[model samples]
Target: MSEIRKIIEDLRKNKAGMRGILAIIIIFAYGILGSYFIMGLNINNSIYYTVITVATVGYGDIIPVTPLQKLFSTSLALTGLGLLAYIFTIIINSFEENLHDIRSGRHMEKRLAEMENHYILCGFGRVGTAVYEELMKRNQKVIIIEKNDEKLEDIEEDDNVIALHANATEDKTLKKLNIDKSLGVIVTTGSDVDNLFIVLTTRELYEDAWIISRASKKESIKRLKNAGANKVISPEVSGGNDIYFAAVQPNLVHITQNHGIDFLEREFEILKKHNCHLENIEYHFPGIRTPVTRTIGVLDEEEKDHFIDMVKNNPEVKESLDVMYNSVNGVHSHWISGPDKTHVDMAIEELKKEGNLLGINLDFKEINEFTKQFKE
Candidate 1:
């Protein structure tokens, strides 16, 4: 009984892995040969007799003749028929177990560990399907996490798709999907609260990962962003804009539809058609900051020239307070600009001894909200 239980467990875990199949093959071969020699039967007759006996349909026409022949037939019938029945029953049960595992998404766990830099798309509703289709067209590796089995059904038609039929908002599910190494994440579930929670969970797991989430309601957009989404898209807002653009500016809509041209390429092509020339395009993130309008002001007109003369040559003072800056010249890149911030304190301190720092700002990250929005 213990051995049978172990065999069943093995078959459940790894279908057709037990010694049953091999043992059946060996038994069949043994029975065929034993019948041919011991019963003094020809190859064809031996095969027919062995099969019929194993199937418990022994015909009188292929009867064993003597004691040796009858003994071989008895042994062959008992062993082959018993083993075949046992293996057949177990195989059927194993197949059903395998199907259950597949339906419940248990089989996906092994493959997730091998994936890195894949996309985690958490949802399989109408919006999620659209995102998935776009990703598929781009030939991206994506792992879909959808709770509804019916919603996940379409993706299974795609053989390469690896989907986890589970709740996306759960941390355990995200861990199973290997969210830490994912290149990016998309949350387009119907529920705004669920999407927001998934985004927060994902951010906690992998802080710097780029996450694009859908806001089912307009109010949820800001809430999702505050919860740590890199980009919170209100589908209603976006779809309305697209519909408006398609109606009002069809050509612009047509041009933007080509996602490969979502960058500056579309503009270059448009300009080129009318004999316009495009210089090289450079993307400066955290933008090239303009210097402050006022950094050094003086209430004392008397000491203005004296202070200027002292600090003119020593403008780049080393004693200014530690702040982030772009270190193109050995300066640490953490420099935050807006020299207006520190010059007052520096000037007050500078009154004691050396020249003051006529401020120059430091590094600003590329694609900062200011730089992204306010393009000159």
Candidate 2:
């Protein structure tokens, strides 16, 4: 309803166009009046005759019997035909104008210029589509740049998504999207070369721009990073790793795939809190949790200092501290008693802020609960 109102408003924007439409309406009314009063026909028959004559149907059922009637009818038919031709011309011109707007991107230019702090997503292929949906779900501000006209048609007309039919590799297109004011950019084109170029162009345009790009080949990863991408992900490699893990560590796969990272974080924190008493110099973090065996990835110089002080005071606390440092490092944290789910989540988020630490993630709720014992 709102869109219809908007379209009507736009149609009326041209005063000449509205006047022409009004003229057509008045002419139709005149024809009906002349057919009824002047031609001495009944009102119903008068409307019917006028409509048919203007349409040029000429059924020949009703004849203008008198000489004056015939002359009046002939004039009405000719005038109606001329007006009909004019109306057709107006419709054609309006259609051409709209088509030109779509082709030239004039419709999007102003809207794009007004957007800021939005995300720019390049390409609309499979990967790009997934990213777009996820961003939409998160309620992020996103604008899509897709070159393929066929793919753009897939987007529903009523959807709130902003899609541009333009190549993203061009600097002019990026500028039009207000990339300089955007928070981040995602490049999901299948071609590594294209993704790299987009990253480079985006980086050049916005120095502080956060860019994440997809690369198909291993070598393309480093090149994309060098081109100024914050993160370069290879879907093939990640998919292969998932497959390998699913086969070798089926239980682990089920835990991660179904329960989510929160479940793991909560569970890990629980185990660590219970086992805090058994922290020895030869202590292991994941060994007691399950049958699986893997070396811990975290390295903490800060925790090492705190652990030495603990060993002299209470050797058990030092041992427990060692397991935490071995699991997650490079964070200022402190231990808290009787942790709940909320605290466990907050601690996990806090740990994540330290960024990637050796990529060896564990499922221990107690780990996070007791993980962050920091000096005030």
TM-score of each: 0.41, 0.43
> Number of the top candidate by lDDT?
2
Measured with C-alpha atoms, the lDDT of residue 157 in candidate 1 is: 32
Total backbone collisions for each predicted model:
14, 22
Expressed as tens digits, the lDDT of each residue in 263-366 for candidate 1 is 22333233323322221122223345532222221113344335444433444532221111211111111111111213323322332232211222213443
lDDT per residue (tens digit) for residues 77-167 in model 2:
9988988887677666766776787776765776777776566789888877766665553334678898998888877532335788899
* RMSD after Cα superposition, model 1: 19.0
**Could you tell me which 10 consecutive residues in candidate 1 have the lowest summed lDDT?**
250-259
Q: After superposition, how far is residue 349 of candidate 2 from its true place, in Å?
A: 13
